[model samples]
Target: MKVAALLIADPEGPDPCRLVHGAPLLRHAVAGLLASGCADRLVVAVPKSALGDCEVIIRAVPGAGSRCRVLACGADRAESARLALDAAGESADVVLVHDVARPFVPPATVRAVAEAVLAGAEAIVPVLPVTDTVKLVSGGVIESTSDRDRLRVVQTPVGYRPDVLGKVCARGSDPLSDLPGSVRTVAGHPTALRLTTAFDVAVAEALLEEQG
Candidate 1:
């Protein structure tokens, strides 16, 4: 099955790009996709402002690195992603959306999501089990404890049928931040390692080494 990966890059050289995490993070994602050779095509989109930066990334890689077609997209995340979809053109049987911050997406997880879709599920999301007990706070009072098993910590590389994702984008604005939990769930990869802050990046780096 054909698959596409959309990387929503800030392009302004955000903290994710700093020496600590940025370059390594993108490298991790691209390397995995390249190695997987799972998708017929894989592409990355950065804001027009960040095109130069992405180019620098390609230049550093040993291969031609042209497999990932980078683009200068709109200001918003959904817009940029939707633009990538438009450019991808083929509307592959399945489409996988990933974030640069989540550089540690395992190839196994990628295969799992694809399996799910091929198994007839329209959408599939990857999530890790939460280790910490969660407290539900209501009106400043502890409501109750939550079952960690029932609650999964969603990760990125969420797989969806291209048509489904495109339709969702058409119904509303490009998928943006502050989406509902369910919406977020649809966007996680089972083996995803999100790099939001400095600490997250370090954890991801450690995980990558272990994975390697």
Candidate 2:
């Protein structure tokens, strides 16, 4: 099956997706997808202004130069996704959208998502069940406690049938908030945690050292 992956890299951020251990986070994201052999083509999206810098980074990764290309990311995550889908063409049977911030997703998770999509899933999101006590609060007042068992911490490499994804992308709005509610789940690994703060980067660095 023809599958394609889109790794979203915002051009600006408080914790910009830049180099870690001598390689850009986008490169790490690409290597995981490439290693998985799940996506036939990979697209990395950065700000239009950063396309040249992104190209330079892609070229540094040994075999990535051939399998991956850079796209100009849009103003928001939704638009960025749309931009990637457009560049990916309509030939892909399945498309996986990954966050550049979540740079260490295991290849096993990527393959699992692809296989699930092939096995008749329309939209698949890998999730780690919430284990912490959840709460709802407003103005420093506790509203109610949430059911932890019913909560899931969603992770990336979210998969979709290309047609389904294309339709959603066509809306040109925030897919996360605008897409239909139906979703499938696959187990996620801790290593797939997203990098949001400096602490996240530190944790990832430590994890990488252990993996090595």
Candidate 3:
């Protein structure tokens, strides 16, 4: 199966070009995907202003020359995803959408998501079991306590068949939402944590140092 991965870097979000572990976070994501060998093609959607910078970053990754394409993303996440899907084209049988912010996503997780799509799963998402206590808060008051065992924290490189994703995108629907087909889950790695705040960046840097 021909797999295509979409890496999105929203303009409104934290700077994807921010250096982490001696390389831009976006570069890390692109390199990780390339290292995984799960996709036949890689389509990166970045902020309009960062197009040229992103192109340079992607080009710097070894073995990314022909397989990677960088383009300006849409205003919102769904639109950005749709634009990337369009860029991925009809040749790709499976599509995986991932956040560029989650630069430490394990290559094994990437391969697993793609493999599940190849195996017959209509839609796939890697998820980690929620370990924190659950609480329902309304305004400032705690409403109730819920079960955490049934909860799962969703992670990316979400996989889908090309046609299914196309239809979802065409309708402007979130790909992670309920779709026409069943969405299956696979084991997620802690390294796949989505980076958002400065604290998250600090944690990622700490992880990198520990690994080295």
Largest lDDT belongs to which candidate?
3
TM-score: model 2 vs. ground truth: 0.92
lDDT of 1 by residue, 77-128 (tens): 6777788788777658877776666666767777777667656666677777
Better of 1 and 2 by lDDT: 2
- Find the number of clashing residue pairs for candidate 3: 0
**Global CA lDDT computed for model 1:** 0.64
TM-score of each: 0.81, 0.92, 0.95
Q: Mind giving the per-residue lDDT tens digits that candidate 2 earns over 1-212?
A: 88899888754542223777567777787788888887899888887776887788778776786678787888888888898888888988889988888878999999999999989999888899998999999999999999998899888888989888878888775554344466688999888888877788888888878998
Q: Candidate 2: misplaced stretches above 4 Å?
A: 11-17, 176-179
Ranking by lDDT: 3, 2, 1
Which regions of candidate 3 deviate over 4 angstroms? 176-181
Clashes of 2: 0
Report the C-alpha displacement of residue 136, candidate 1, in angstroms: 1.0
lDDT of 2: 0.81
Q: What TM-score should be assigned to candidate 3?
A: 0.95
Residue 169 in model 3: lDDT? 92
